[model samples]
Target: MTFDVKKEEKQFYSAKGPELIKIPSMDFMAIRGTGNPNDEGGAYQRAVQTLYAVAYTIRMSEKAGISLPGYEPYVVSPLEGLWWQDGYAGVDLNKKSDFQWWSMIRLPRFASHEILDWAKNTAAEKKKIDTSDIQWFTYDEGLVVQAMHHGPYATEPETVSEMNDFVSDHELKEDFSTRYHHEVYLSDPRKIAPEKMKTILRHPVKK
Candidate 1:
């Protein structure tokens, strides 16, 4: 099912702090890129490709009776981002026309690293259409602040601004190296209107 990039925000949980939270992410894989994303067509294309690959992994895992923590089986798209410039926390669209640096990581919940490694390799094999090189991570603990983003991507600035405010009001500091922009998509773009699509944007901040 194709998910709409814009629309309504779905139900999700997020918090701020230096505490470890239990997140049961379903089985999925991620592809990482480290250059300007827009400049590198391969990066963007592969990012999208990985999504399908991991989605299928979730289906296969369920069929095999493998249960994951926070095992919603739904696609979770959390981005590891860097904001060198002041105020903004995402891709610099204007300068990103050719060489945008970015990476896409997939989160899957499991009891041990053994299954996690297997899942990553399995997803890569299934999605052989794209580059097989990717990374696997078990983000067991970190400070995360998330919120539901309503409306279009163009209007995401407001949501981001609010998130920043929350961080400030709560006396949270940002850890640049570990800072990331996490997103979970629930609406199928092919089936929902742009204004009605929802996306959850989560950013990591130090408490």
Candidate 2:
């Protein structure tokens, strides 16, 4: 059976309250790009396309006789992103056109180094697009305070303030070195209304 990380890894996806979760190290297929996501065919849009090109290549590796141990056909995880700008702890939503972001999709443990390389090469060959910027990233988010934000992405500051209040209440300070700010998009923006979009907001912290 296909191992669905979101369904099996319960703690990673479900959060209705401002709760703290300890997450271990996980590898990701990541690409760093700058500028507004709404820009017409800009870096932000291309980064996402590259991410999926490599992601689907790896997902369909079996067709190429590339078999992996303990592997089963499974759905790809939801799109996730790490947000921040140089020398800034928080991003200015109003200035999204100038925002910098590291867009990534979490790679399962079964996806090995060799498999990732194969996917990169395959994507380049089949799609005839540059996949050089994509790299394997190891992230160890030891302890984080997270909350479920139910609304539009444009109105996320209110939730961030709430998370900050929760963090201070527990005597924990934000750890900027580990990560700037993290978000897991649960709803498809194309299909879901902005008011109904679900995003998991996470902040790295130290006690």
- Number of the predicted model whose lDDT against the real structure is largest: 2
Residues 20-133, candidate 2: write the lDDT tens digits.
Answer: 888888889999888888887898789889989999887887877877675678778878888877667666667786677889898866788887887898899999999999
Cα TM-score per model: 0.59, 0.92
Error of 2 at 5 (Å): 0.3
lDDT of 1 at 197: 65
| Per-residue lDDT of 1 in model 1 | 42
Taking every candidate in turn, the Cα RMSD to the unseen true structure, in Å, is: 7.0, 1.7
Instruction: Candidate 2: give the clashing pairs.
Output: none
- Report every candidate's CA lDDT: 0.52, 0.85
Q: Give the TM-score of candidate 1.
A: 0.59
Per-residue lDDT of model 1, residues 33-145, tens digit only: 54444344566556655655654565468666877554444444443332233355543434443333334444433324555556657776765654345445444325566
Model 1 misses residue 173 by how many Å? Answer: 2.4
Window of ten residues with lowest summed lDDT in model 2: 85-94
